[model samples]
Target: MKLDNLYIKDDTRNPTLSFKDRASAVGIAKAKELKKDVIVASSTGNAASSISGFAASAGIKNYIFVPKTAPEAKVTQLLVFGSTVFLVDGTYDEAFELCFKAAERFGWYNRSCAINPYLVEGKKTVAFEILEQLNFKVPDYVVMAVGDGCSISGAYKGFVEFYKLGLVDKIPKMIGVQSEKSNPVTRAFNKNTYEFDYIPPTTIADSISVGIPRNGIKALKAVAESGGFMIDVSDEEIIESIRILASNSGIFGEPAGVTGFAGVRKLKKLGLLKKEDIVVTVVTGSGLKDLKTAQ
Candidate 1:
């Protein structure tokens, strides 16, 4: 709230209670069109649940790989949706590697955003939805948490699509937020470099606890092309922002979901955001996804 003229896009209301639903919806639709019989993806939690649910609806087999540290609720959601869940006894990066290998070997359609371009294409819908909600007005900044970076990159693509269609005059600056514990993208951005160096995650926000983000290249491109920046927020800041968002806006988001709000506060402290500038922060997931951490 201190960031005056700030708006929140409550993507937590999406089916499966996270922004991944949008991406999964699109990916599943495309797979169905291609007559694919199975879809596979790796996620700490949200994307797995989303893909499982969407693939179930489409009458396709779904397989998901998740780090063993992923929350129980998310795993349960996948099981309830009939997904063949693989709990990798390693980091999210390992899970992603295994998922990709399996997808390739089995000829299963990969629904992972980092591996597949169509997932980003689906994720662009969020930007379209936000712009339509705001009556086609482009805000000064659009902020969101990044893990594999598909969401923000897709958002940039949506803005660019609108710009190409002459529906908007300019694209908003994309401000990507990540946890300091798992911030390959932030490290790359801060160092003014593009090389990705893996760092094992040590944060409680499991959804964004990716060490080596597969979409690091595209994510870096989104920030640089849009004249945007990536910032890292501490776990303490993320937890506090979660409570703050729920208290002030009645939006109960998981820690990763409120990570960008923490970034907005940081930007305000640095005097980067003006009171008159409109800022929109995307809340990417529901608190229910990680209720144990929320407590």
Candidate 2:
């Protein structure tokens, strides 16, 4: 909270109104390159709607699997895009596994964020855009909510690629935030281990309610190698952050999307963030995506 400069990379303005659009766009392109006509994906809400929208625009077929508890607004988006939607009656982890197996069995291109390497390549563009918007100046810290871990990992990869190309002199510390009720990545970081056991998520932030983070190792490495840390915020904190961000900055972020800002406040309270540091927190999705909780 004492940072000299604080910025929010508002991805809610994307075509699909979420940061997942970045990866979904790439996935659709990759499916074409592979000569695949049908793409399959699993998500809580954001990724499903994103891929569904892109697939519709591209005239390609898409099948989406999401937990039955996914926000109605997101489900409506999928239906509007004419995607084959399966409301899986289980947790997000179960839906992901189901989609994974189905994709393999049916030879459909899997667009799941954590499983597809190419999708992460798409996600890296967020980092590129952030630096470009900042006049190619890297911030002291880059914060984002972590679910299956692909987004944060991709952001870190982007920064490292830019650093390798001398586009930037340094990589910002990659701070990952998760809901305390669904915090496998944060738990692993706290334990100083990469291996984490599955812990059923019970968070109100459906977008980040991942029990078994599919890309957990990469996310852990991203935080550790960047000399950053992982943190968890309560659902109450996430809700308060949504209000704070909207009222203070006029940025309406969903519960999960604003989780990083919650972690930032927590870190400041814990005396971990410095007054001189510049910080950037990514708002991954629009508040409209989960209006029930936002209200």
Indicate which candidate wins on TM-score: 2
User: Each model's TM-score, in the order given?
Assistant: 0.97, 0.98
In angstroms, how far off is 95's CA in candidate 2? Answer: 0.3
Task: Report lDDT (CA) for all predictions.
Answer: 0.90, 0.93
Worst 10-residue lDDT window for candidate 2 reads 1-10
Residue-wise lDDT of candidate 1 within 1-295, one digit each (tens)? Answer: 3655899999899889999998998899899899998889999999999999988888899889999889999999999999999999998889999999998999999988877877887889988988999999999999989898888998999999999999999999999999889899999998888788877789998888988787877888998899999988899999999898899999999989999899998899888898889899999999999988889
Q: Give the clashing residue pairs of candidate 2, or none.
A: none
Tens digits of per-residue lDDT for model 2 on 1-295? 4577889899999999999999999999999889998999999999999999999999999999999999999999999999999999999999999999999999999999777879988999999999999999899999889998999999999999999999999999999999989999999999999888887899999999998899999999999999998988999999999999999999999999899899889988899888887899999999999999988
Error of 1 at 84 (Å): 1.0
| lDDT over C-alpha atoms for residue 1 of model 2 | 46
Candidate No. with top lDDT? 2
